[model samples]
Every structure is written in C-alpha cells, then in structure tokens.
Target: MNPILEIQQLTHTYSAGTPFQRTAVEGVDLSVMPGECVGIIGHTGSGKSTLIQHFNGLLKPTSGHVLVDGRDIWAKGSDIRAVRFRVGLVFQYPEYQLFEETVAQDIAFGPKNMGLAADEVARRVRDASAVVGLDESLLSQSPFALSGGQKRRAAIAGVMAMEPDVLVLDEPSAGLDPRGRQEMMAMLGRYRQQRGATVILVSHSMEEIAANVDRVIVMNQSKVFMDGAPREVFSHVAELEAVGLDVPQSARIAALLRDRGLAVGEDVYTVAALARRLLALKGGGGVC
Candidate 1:
C-alpha cells in the first residue's frame, strides 16, 4: 500500500543564523502507510517533535520535503490549511488549547474553523464526542470546569471532530493517571479501528509504544536509528539502551530471566504475554 505521508531527506534547524543556531533534525526519511499505527521513540532532544511538525506544514523543512497523499505539502500556492485539516495534530498536553466557553464549543472549534455548516458541525461534534467518550450533557458546561482527564478528552474531541485522514499525537497521555492513560489508549485504538485513519504517536515510554503500536521508529542524535516491528526493535535492547532509551519493562525482565537459565521468551514487551510465559515456567517445575 502506498504511504499516506512521506518525509524525504528531511532536515530542520531551530534558531538558525544566530548565536543560538542548532540543528534539530537531519537527513530523516519516514513513511506512514495507510491505516498504520507508527510509534516514534527517542531520547530527550532526539528531534522527534521537530520531525513530526513537518508532516502537516506546521514547520517547513529547512531542506527536503514532506509529501501528503503524493503531493508536496510545501509546494508553491499549496493549501496548507487544507493539508492541516487532512492531518490532525494533537500536541502534547492538548488540554491547553481548549479555549471556548463550553465543551461543545471547544469540540466544534475545528469544524467551525473549516466553515462547515452548523448542522454538519454538530454532527461532527457528536461523532467525535462518541469516539472520545465525551458525554452530551457535559457539552453545555464550560471546558475549564471539567477535570483534567475530561479536559484532555475535550481537546482530543476538538481534533477528532475534523475527521482527519491522518492523526498525529505527541504524548497524548503525558500527564494522565494510569487509568486515564489506559482509557486514552483504548479510545485511540477504537478511533483507529472505526475510522482506519493512519496514526503516528511520539512517545518516550517504551511500554506505551510496545503496547500500542504496530511499528516502532527509534531516533538517536537526530537520525533514524531503527525502524521495525515492536518485537524486532525490542530485541535490540543493548543498542536502545546505549542511545538512552530503554526496552519495555517486560522485555527487560524477560532478558533477566533468560540470563538466569530460564527459557522464558525474547522481546516480550506486554505484561499479559510475559505473565503467561512466566506462569508456564513455574507450572513446568522450572526454578524461578
């Protein structure tokens, strides 16, 4: 399948041509296939955020190009506004973007900006609210009146209402509690399953990436370090650790068990999967 988004030989520099000039990303090539979920991982300052900002024209590349649906996003006279509508971006701590007086208005913000008719905007608001599990009753209340998790959902609903072909989230669950994080992930999964939208997530948490993504892309020193299936990437624990990124907890524990002479499993990143293997080892009379 053809990719929905492509980044070719992309490079970006922040604070250019001054004493603060610094290269943020360099020579990165990335592609996201239709209906695929790709997780991006990197250490602090690895340029993950800077790299994704180029996808929808939020940040134009210093060199190279970003193509969406086979067209250069930065092409002369290209409708960047339309490209943004097609590629929704949920920034880290999206709740900070919610500014409307009420939840309904907050969720309606995107469709309203698109100049969609009121009835169409209402329909979209309802559809997005369902995806994010926001209640219709709460729509009448001020967005700021909601709890932090609810505020986050409201912010997400704002973006989801656009029904973008591609959804990019930068640490969407950054500050949520464990239950909230699980709920957010479940919502994202359901959103993908229902809409078949291409999703890209930038997260530093190895466990979150392992559990949620079909493919993993690792970044180090502003370059693509590795790109593969979750199991394949997790198997290279030492290399990841060397880059200041850890393998998933289950993978670490599995490695420890293997070193102790138990044939548990390799690249085991999910708790449930590792639990099953550990239980089998115990039941089979193997020493723990």
Candidate 2:
C-alpha cells in the first residue's frame, strides 16, 4: 500500500543565517499509511512539533522534502493551501484560536475557507459537531461561554468539519481531566473510523499512545530514536529510559515483577494484558 504521507530526510532550521539559528529537526525520515493511527512521543524541545508542521506545509523544510500521496508538497507551483485542507492540524490549546461568535460558526470556519457551498458547510458543521459531542443547543452560543473541554471540542470540530483525509493532533488531550481526555480520544477514534482517516497523534503520555496507536515513533535530539508497534517499542524499556522517556505503567510494573522472579513478559504494556499475565501465573484462578 502507498503511504499517505512521507518525509524524506526533512530538516528545519529556525532563524536561519542568524546567530540564534538552530536546527529543530535534522535528517528525519518517516511515513504514515492510509487509515493508520501513529503516535509521536518525545521530551520537551525534541522537535516533535517542528517535524509535524511540515506535514501540512505550515513550515517549509530547510532541506529534503515532504510528500503527500507521491507528490512533493513543495514542488514548484504546487498549491500549498490545498494541502492544509487535506491534512487537518489541531494544535495544543486550540481553544485559544477559536474566535467565531457562535460554536457553529467556529466549526464552519474551515469548510467555509475551503469554499464549500452553504448547504455543504452546514452539513459539515452538523456532522463535525455530532462527532465531537457538541450539542445543537450550544451552536448559537459564543465559544468563550463554553467550559474548557467544550471549547476544545468546538475547536477540534472546526478542523474535523473540513473532512481531511489525515488528521494530525498535537498534545490533543492536554490540560483535560481523565474523563475529558477519554471522551476526546473516543471522539477522535469515532471520527477516524467513520472517515477512514489516517491519524497522527503527538503526545507525551506513554499510556495514551500504548492504548490508542497502531505504531509509536519516539523522538530524541531532533531525530527518530525508535519507531515500531507499541509492544515492540515498549519492550525496550531500558533504552527508552536511557533517553529520558517513560514506558507505560503496566510495562514498568511487569518489569518489576519479572525482576522479582515472576514470568511476566516485557511486552505487557496495557492494564488488561498485565492482569491476564498475572492471572495465568496464578494458574488461571479468578481474582476478586
């Protein structure tokens, strides 16, 4: 299968030709296939945000290229604005960017920018609002009147209204309570399933990545430190820790149990999987 998004040795240097010039991302290469959900995790200032900005032409590469569907997005005369509609990006604290007077207007902003018809924009607003769990009653209210979580939902609905083939979220669940985080992720999952969209999630939470993504990409020092399935990547707990990254809690606990002479596997990164492993060690006895 063809990759929906591809990065070829991409590099981005900030403030080029100045004394403060520094490379945020250097010689990084990666790909995302259609309908796949991938997570990117890194320490602060590890270039995760810089790297993703290239996906939708938000930041032009200093060298190399970013390709969307076999075509370089930076090719001469290519329409960069069209790429933004194909790859929807929701930044951290996106609620701060919501400026429309009404929730519905905010959600319709992207679709309207794409020059969609009135009927089509209205349909997108309704569909995106429902996907994000926004109520019709709130459509007429100002975005600032909503709670933090509701504002976030409205902001995300704005991007979803564009019906992008690839949705990229950076720290999407930041600052939310556990329930709110779960609800937000559930909404994204539903959106991906319904649209068959490829999802790229950039987060610092190992548990969130382990539970939701098909693949994980660990970044360090402006490079791809590790890239693999969650189980595959988490199995290298020592390497991850060496680079100041955390593994999931279940994986850490399983490692501790194994150190104490238990037979738990290093690949146990989920709560249910760890529980089952312990149960099997107890000869399949039921736990109260």
Candidate 3:
C-alpha cells in the first residue's frame, strides 16, 4: 500500500540568516500509511511539533519535500488549501482558535469553508459532534460557555467535520481529566475505525502511545531516533533513557521483573498484559 503522507529528508530552520538561526527539524524522513495509527514521543525540543507542521503545509520545509498521496504539497500550482482540508490538523489548545458564536457554527466552519452545501455541512456537524461525544443540545450554546473538555471536543469536531483523509493531532489529551482523556482517546479510536483514515498523534504520554498506536516513532535531538512497533521501541529502555525519554511504566516494571528471572517477555507494555503474563507463569509453575 502507498503512503498517505510522506516526508523526505525534511528540514525546518527558524530565523534563517540571523543570529537566532536554529534548525528544529534536521534531515528527517518518514512515511505514514493509509488507515494506520502512529504515535510520536519526544522531549520538549525534539522537533516533533515542527515536523508535524509540515505534514499539512502549516510550515514549509526549508530543504525537503512533503508529499500527500504522491504529490508535492509545495509544488508550483499545488493546492495547499486542499492539502489542509485533506490532512486536517488540530493544533495544541485548538479550543483557543474557536471564535464562532455557537458550537454548531464552530463545528460547521470547516465543511462550510470546503464549499459543501448547507445540508451536507449540517450533516457533518451532526456526525462530527456525535463522534466527539457532544450533546445535540449543546450545539445551540456559545462555545465560550462550555467547560474546557467540552470546548476541546467542539474544536476537534470542527476539524473532524471536514472528513479529512488524514487526521494529525498534537496532544489531543493534553490538560484533560483522566475520564476526559480516556473519552477523547475513545473518540479517536471510534473515528479511525469508522473512517479508516490515517491518524498521527504527538503526545508526551508513553502509556497512552503504548496502548493506542500501531507504530511508534521516537524523536531525539531534532532527528528521528527510533521507529517501530510500540513494544519494539519501548524495549530499548537504555537507549530511550539515554536520550532523556521514558519507556512506559509497564515496560519498565516488566524489565525489572525480567532482571530477577521472571521470564516476562519484552512484548509487555501494559499493566494488564504484564499481569496476564505473570499469572500464566504462576499457573504453569514456571520459574518466578
């Protein structure tokens, strides 16, 4: 299968030709396949945010190409606006970007901008709201009146309404209560399952990534450090820790158990999975 999004030797530098010149992303290459879920983990300055901004042309590459469906987004006469619509980006604190008078108006903004008719736009707003777990009654109220979590969901609904082929979210669960964060992840899972769209998430939480993503990409020193399945990437505890990144808690605990001869495999990255392995070991009277 072809990649829905591709980054080739991508680089982005801030304040070029000035005293403050610095490259946030340097010589990075990546590909995101259709209907796949990817998680990226990095420290504060690992260039994760800068790299994702190029996915939808929010920022142009300084020296490389970003392609969507085999077409260069930066090519002459390329429809960047179309790219934005296809690869919808929900930035961090997207709620702060909402300015429409009502929730429904805010959610309808993207599809309406896409030139869809009123009926289709309304349908999208309805469906998107339902997907994000927003109440139909709240649609009539002002966005500013909603709670933080509600506003977050409404803002996400706006982007989801566009029905993008690829969904790129930065910290979709940031600053939410545990229940709210769980609901947000559940919403994303349902959206991907229902639409078969490629989803890319940049998150700080290793546990969330371990449980949710099919592929994990670890960034370090403004470059791609590791890329693999969650279990594979997190298994490199020493390398990840060397770069000031932490493996998932379950993986760390599993590693500790393995050191004492529990025979717990490296595939364990979740508490439930680790517990099952331990239970099976005890059941069969394997060396603990």
Candidate 4:
C-alpha cells in the first residue's frame, strides 16, 4: 500500500539566490505509512520544522516533491487548503494563535474552515474538547481568559476538530510542565488511536519521543541523519550525541549497568521495561 505521505529529494533554502542563502533541508527522502506515528528529533536549526511544513503544503519544497497519498500536494490548482484540513499542523505554542471569543469557537475554527455543517461543527468541537480534557463549562468561557495550558489545549482541539488523517505537531508540549506534557501526550495518543491517523511529532525531548513514537527520525546538518525504530535509532548513541541528541534515560542507565557487568538488555528504553529486565536478572528478586 502507498504511504500516507512521501517526501523525495526535498530541499528548502532560505533567502534563495542571495549571499545569505542557506539550505534548511536537503535531499531528504522520507515516508510515513498509514496509521504510523513518527517522531523527529533535532537540535535547533536542524531543519525538522522546515521538513514538516512541506507535509501539508504550508511551505513548498524548493526542488522536490511532497506527495500525500500518492498525489503531489503541489499539483496544479491542488486544493492546498484542503490539504491543510487533511493534514492538521499544531505549531509550537499553538495557544498563542487562539483568538476566538470562547473556547468552543476556538475549537471549531478548523472544522468551520473546512465548511462543515453547524451541527457537525458543534459535534466535532465537543469531541475534540473531550480529547484534550477541556471541561464542558470551559467551552463557554473566553479563550483569552484561560490559563496557558488551557489555552494550549483549546488550540490543539481546534486542530483535532478537523479530524485530519495525518496530524503533524511541532513541539506540542514544548512549554508545559511534566504533568501537562504527559497529559498532552496521552491525549494525542488517544486521538491517534480513535482516528487511526498518521502522527508526525517534532520534539527536542528524546524521552518523550522514545516513549511514544513507533519510529524516530534524527535530523542533522539540514539532512536526515538516521531513521528507524526507537531502539534502532537509539542504539547509535555516539552519532546521536554528536548530532546534539541523546538516547532515553533508561537506555543510558541500561548501558551503565551493562558496562558494570550486569546482564541488562541494551534495548531497554522505558523505565518500566528496564526495571522489569533488571528484576528478571535478579531471578525475580528485588534489584541486586
């Protein structure tokens, strides 16, 4: 089956034909299968943001093609606006974009943009708000009056209301606290499961991506440095570190134990997984 999204030889240059011109993404070939969750990790200016922008026609590639479901997104008169509805993008600090009079209106913005019926829009708004855990009463309150985290949830709901087939989020939990971040991720996971949508998340946090994504793509020097499952990608610790990324904490701890002669599994990444492996090493007893 064809992938949900495909990018071939994609390149993007800022300030083209000028002395200060610099390529933010170069010759990047990537694909996301239907219903797959992919995570992208890179340091600032590594081009991750630039790459995702191409997925939904937010930014046209300078010299390559971005295909959505086997069709070039830039095909003549290609309803790029419809593409945006099909591939919802949640930008970093999305809350800052909320300008509606109330949370319900904010959440309905995307669906309304899609020209949905009034009843359908209302239903979508409530469903999306529930996904983000926004209370029913809060829907009537002005978005500007909500707290930072609440505002963020409202904005995210705005995108969720579109029910996009491919959800692309750029640092969805960037400024949230630990609990808030965890909650946001859980909500996103639930949404992905319910819709069976393809998810592409861009984050600087190795731990978050390691715990959630089915595959991880590492970006470095404006190109794809590595692409594989979490275990496969994290196995190359040295290269990742060189690219300003790190393996998950549990992976590092497991490595330490292996270095000290413990038979810990090198593939362990999650804390619970590592703990289970270590306990098994102790013959079902407590940590040795």
TM-score of each: 0.96, 0.97, 0.98, 0.97
TM-score of candidate 1 relative to the true fold: 0.96
Taking every candidate in turn, the Cα RMSD to the unseen true structure, in Å, is 1.3, 1.7, 0.8, 1.4
Error of 1 at 195 (Å): 0.5
Task: Give RMSD (Å) of candidate 4 vs. truth.
Answer: 1.4
The best candidate by lDDT is: 3
Q: Write the per-residue lDDT of candidate 1 for residues 152-264, one digit (tens) a residue.
A: 99999999999998999999989887898899999999889889998899987888999999999999999999999998998888888887789999988887888888887
Scored by lDDT, model 2 comes in at 0.94
Q: What lDDT tens digits, residue by residue, belong to model 3 across residues 198-228? A: 8999999998999899999999988999999
| Residue-by-residue lDDT tens digits, candidate 2, 178-268 | 9988898899999999999999999988988988999999999999999999989998889999999999999899888878878887678
Model 1 has an lDDT value of: 0.91
Stretches off by above 4 angstroms in model 4 are 284-287
Q: Which consecutive 10 residues in model 4 have the weakest lDDT in total?
A: 278-287
> Which 10-residue window of candidate 3 scores lowest in summed lDDT?
176-185
Off by over 4 Å in 1: none
lDDT of 1 at 106: 88
lDDT of 3: 0.94
Q: lDDT of each prediction vs. the true structure? A: 0.91, 0.94, 0.94, 0.91
Best by TM-score: 3
Look at candidate 2 and tell me the lDDT of residue 159.
97
Candidate 4's residue-wise lDDT over 223-280, tens digit each? 9999999988877777777767788888888777877877776578888889789878
Candidate that beats the other on lDDT, 2 or 3, i.e. the better one: 3
Q: Decide which is better by TM-score, 3 or 4.
A: 3
lDDT of 3 at 275: 86
